[model samples]
Target: MKKKFLMVFIVIVVVMTFFTPSYAKNTVEFPEEDSTELQYQDMIMLFLGSHIDQAISDHYSFYLKKDPIVYPYQIEVKKVKRINEFREFHFVIILEVTPVVGPHITVGKDKLIFEVSPTIPGKVKLLKFEHLETHELPPVWMHLLKKKPSL
Candidate 1:
C-alpha cells in the first residue's frame, strides 16, 4: 500500500509541474517625441472640430430644419504656451456654415485656446473658443432659430 501511494504522489507532482504556466515580463517604452507630438495635434484638432460642429448643429437646427453642413478651413496652430506645468494650445480655424436651402455663410475665423493633460491622452477639455470675426446672422431668422423646449 505504501509503495502504491508513493507512486501516485510522484505521478501527480510531475503532471502538475508540466501544467504550470510561465510568464515573461515585457517592458513598454513611451512613444517617440515626434510621433507623440503628431498624435497630440491630431487629437486636439479632431476634438475641437467635432465639438464646434455639434454646437453649430444644436444652435441652428431650428432655422435649418436639419443639421447645417460645417466646413473647417485654415486650421493653424498659433502658439503653444505653457500655463504652469501644462501646455496650452492656440489655434485659428475658419468655419463655413451652409444650411440646406439657404445660402452658405462664413463665420470668418475663430481663435481657440485649450489645454489637454499630458499623462491622460484620452481627455480633451476645451478652455476657450474666441471668435476672431463675428458675422451676425439675420435677426429676423433668430426667432425661427429658437429651439423648442423639450418635455
Candidate 2:
C-alpha cells in the first residue's frame, strides 16, 4: 500500500505540471491618433498595401499594359490586442484596382489582423486577411451586348 500511494502522488504531480498555464497575458487596447499610434498604423498600412498591389499585379499584370493604378481607401483601425509581447491590430481596407485600358475594374474590401512586436520595430507580420467584399464590374460593352440581345 505504501508503494502504491507514492506512485499515485508522483503521477499527480507530473499531470499538474503539464496542465499549468503559461505566464503570458493577453490584453486589448484601442489605437489612438497620437504620433506613436500613427507611426505603427502607417507601417501596417504600407505593408498591407504592398501585399495587395503585388497580388493584383501577379494576377492581372497582362491587363495593365498601359498604366496600372491601385487606390486604397476607407482604411479603419478596429481594435488592437496584445498577446504575450506582440501587438495585434485589426482593421479594414478597401482597394480599387484599375487596369489603364481595361473595361473591367476590380474592387476588393478586406478586414485584416496584423501582429508586431513593440520591442522590435519594423517586424510587422500579417495574421489574417479576410475579404468582406470582392467583385469585378462588367464592361460597358457587355451591358450593351446584353441589351441588344434582349431587343
Candidate 3:
C-alpha cells in the first residue's frame, strides 16, 4: 500500500510539474535579472514554439502544417526595452511576414507582440494581437492569447 501510494504521488507531481504549460491565464511576475541579447532571443523563440504547437489550421506546406496566422516568412524586430512596474519585461512586435523577407513593412497589417519574461527564458506571453489581414487565433488560443499583465 505504501509503495503504491508513493508511486502514484510521484507520478502526479512529475506530470503536473513537467508536462504542464509554463504559463498561466493569470498574470505572472518575473524577477529582476539582467537578460542578455541571446536570452531575449531565446525567449522569443521559445514563446513562438509553444504557440506554434497550439495554433489551429488544416493548411499544410509539405509535411509541416502551416498555421492560419503565425506563418513567419519575414520577421521585423523592434528594440527590446523593459516596461511595466518592475521594468523587467521586454517586447517584440512583428508587423509583417513576407517571402522575400527584407525591408520591413512598417504600415499596419497584422501585428502581435511577444512579451518575454526575465525570470524564465521559456516563459512568454502573447499579448495584444491585432489582425489587419485574414489571419486568426486558434480555438485553444482564443482564450489564451489575451495580454496577461504582471501580478
Candidate 4:
C-alpha cells in the first residue's frame, strides 16, 4: 500500500510539471540604454533635494555617450531650487560653450537659471532663461543672456 501511494505521488508531480506554462518567453522587454526618459519623474526630481550635480550628470549621460561633439559644452549644475508647487525643477547651470562654427576653445563661463518641465523632465521652457552671473562670455552668448530673458 505504501509503494502504491509513493508511485501515485510521483505521477502527480510529473503531470503538474508538464502542465505548467513557461513565463520566460512571455516577459516584457525594455530598451537597453539608461535614459532619464525611462525613469519615474518624481523619483528623479526628488534626487535634486540632495545631490544636484550627480543627478544632472546621471540624467544627461545619455547625451554624453555620443562619439562626436558638436558645439560642445561643459555644463555644471550649481544649484537646484524649489519654488511654488512640484510643477518644475529650478536649476542654476554654469556652462562653457564652444561654438561649432567660429571658436573651438573655451569661450567663457555664464551662470544662469533655467526652468525645466517636470512632467516632461528634460524639456526647458524657452522663456524661462534667467542670467544669474557672467564672466568673460562669448559675444553671441553675452548678447543672448544679457537681455531681460523674456521670450
Model 3 TM: 0.33
| Residue pairs with clashing backbones, model 3 | none
TM-score of 1: 0.37
Flag regions of model 1 displaced more than 4 Å.
1-44, 55-70, 82-103, 119-121, 136-151
Tens-place lDDT per residue, model 4, 125-148, is 322223332223344433323232
List the pairs of residues colliding in candidate 1: none
Please report, as a residue range, the 10-residue window in candidate 2 with the lowest summed lDDT: 142-151
Alpha carbon deviation, residue 19, candidate 2 (Å)? 69
lDDT of 3 by residue, 1-151 (tens): 9999999999999989998653222112243775695466456545575454332222112212223333332333444556665554654444332111112211113344666666545656555554344223333444422332221
Instruction: Report the Cα lDDT for residue 126, model 4.
Output: 27
Model 2 residue 2 CA deviation in Å: 99
Task: Give the backbone clash total of model 1.
Answer: 0
Per-candidate TM-scores read 0.37, 0.37, 0.33, 0.27
Error of 2 at 72 (Å): 4.3
RMSD of each: 21.4, 22.2, 17.5, 21.7
Q: Number of clashes in every candidate structure?
A: 0, 0, 0, 0
Cα RMSD of predicted structure 2: 22.2
Q: Could you tell which candidate, 1 or 4, scores higher by TM-score?
A: 1
